[model samples]
Target: MTTPSRYVRSKTAALITFPFSGGQPRKGVELGPEALLRAELPKQLEQLGWGVQLDRSIDWDSINNLLTSDADINSLKNPRSVSKASEELANAIEKHARAGELPITLGGDHSLGTGSMIGLNRVYPDVATIWVDAHADINTAKTTPSGNLHGCPVSFALGLDGSYVEPFKSWLPNPPIASPNRVVFIGLRDVDEGERKILKEQNIKVFSMHHIDKYGIGKVVEMALDYINNGTSRRDRPIHLSFDVDALDPSVAPSTGTPVRGGLSFREGHYICEAIHETGSVVGMDLVEVNPLLESEAAAQTIAVGCSLIRSTLGKLSRLISGETLLD
Candidate 1:
């Protein structure tokens, strides 16, 4: 039998979509939110018995009343815009989370994860986080070589070194939104030298492709869930899954800006979501970085795969229950 979510009071999913991509210097990534919507994301969730609360009431066009000018601070691009947008996204997520509705945020970039983690933490203060991506995304202001805020959202979420600096601190809560002990990463293959030291110094948990190859995806996920849950039970704490499309192999999902080679296969990616669904502890999820403009030829394929992954995360679709798949 499938395990029903303990957090949702009703079968309602807050389809929080944002098109702000000020975090990175990519024009196509901002179109991700609309791409997923055009793919009938709301209807797909409704088929799984969810109400699909599509709330676009927020005036995200103004960047949440930001005084942002295309200025860079501390080598960061669009710091004010990203901070204000993150604050707005965080507030929307917190509202839905407080209403006992599942918040499935469709993001403009992986930087949206900064909002996801911060907002969910407001409700579930002890929420466990699962970051799925090819990159570690733990780069700090001092560590970031490109100055793209997309690569530094994890640092912002954790309040790592240089995270408490200007613009972000004005809205961001005092760091450590979710405890470092409750955060974990999977599918990591490309990690910067600075990010490597940060991960090691902070004692964060990570399962790279090397680990996946050595112990298999199943064991890696099991260990990740256990660590986040403090080894008590996989369902012991609320979970927030931040999925970057780059985690999947370039062949499986090639529409992303930073496509890493030899990433998760179609089945491997779905397995992570399905496993989390089985726990019934996932309260929030963010599907980010599906840049359709980058790969026009394969954009349709990437969108289809992204939608399928979200479905697997939301319900018992790709896995067996009592010796039978849901479709069977």
Candidate 2:
């Protein structure tokens, strides 16, 4: 049996799948969690000796109705519904995190990260986040051209002015536990122009493709962890890894809603998760933006990659999943 530790020790993971896709224009991303489940994700985690608490699937009937409930908020699409769903997701994740179980939320879309992070902060107020994504996902409602909430999760999580927080005012108390310095980004390649200004203005630390090309993923992970942990032991802080599968090379993970080329290699992506696991401070995680409607074969590959990413975060070895003799 595993001994209780300061970070994670219960050997239990609360698997919460947000299978609704109102954050973007995509229709099939909601099916991502089911696809992952169909791939036996829970069984794979069980093989790693993790006792899984599978939460009930989200009831999307009411959520979908709320999507068109309000007029656009400064050109933002479905602001009301997205905020409601995020608030609900935050509550669900908060319950598991407070219980000391690693809360793993499968994708509805990346926008849900707002809720996931807020919920985690309620439990570990000092939690640090390593946002792995191809796009910045930090565009505010005013700056987003597509008006898709998926592209604006980081802004909402950071409590930016353009985010819809009034609806969640009663629930999300003292939100945005993550400050500019505490959060870092990896694998960013297609950042928007406005987001670039925000990144520079907020002094957000980002390791774009340029940085990755220079430093390598190993060094990048080390730097990211060091920044978040602030030279302290991992046990002294909680780590929240918000992984968007698009962070991987399109060839590596193509079934995502937004696939950017020249992303992390398959091994590099797993390396990020493995390194986080080694810290033993992982409190919660979100695997989002997986859309199976993109292409059947590519979707399957992306789903496999998504599952592999989650397995790595949960302390499973890469070879255990594919027998590939990659470095740890």
TM-score, every prediction: 0.94, 0.92
Task: Write model 1 residue lDDT over 175-258, tens digit each, in one string.
Answer: 466466767999999999999999899899999989999998899989988888787654667889999999999999999888
Candidate 2 Cα lDDT to native: 0.82
- How many angstroms is residue 8 displaced in model 1 relative to the true structure, after the best TM-score fit? 1.6
lDDT of 2 by residue, 1-328 (tens): 4512257657888889898788888799989998999989998887776898998645567888887565676677887788888888888988888787888999889989889888888888888888999988998866888888899888878877566455545555555454756679999999899899988888888999888899988988888887777654344468889999999998999888778899999999999999888777788899998899888999999999899898888767734555543422
Question: Model 1 reaches what TM-score against the true structure?
Answer: 0.94
For model 2, what is the error of residue 31's alpha carbon versus the real structure, in angstroms, after optimal superposition? 0.2
Can you give the lDDT of residue 314 in candidate 1?
Answer: 79
Top candidate (TM-score): 1
Candidate 2 residues lying further than 4 Å off, grouped into runs, are 3-5, 68-70, 164-170, 174-178, 231-235, 318-328
| RMSD, every candidate, angstroms | 2.4, 3.0
In model 1, where is the ten-residue run with the lowest total lDDT? 319-328
What's model 2's lDDT at 77? 81
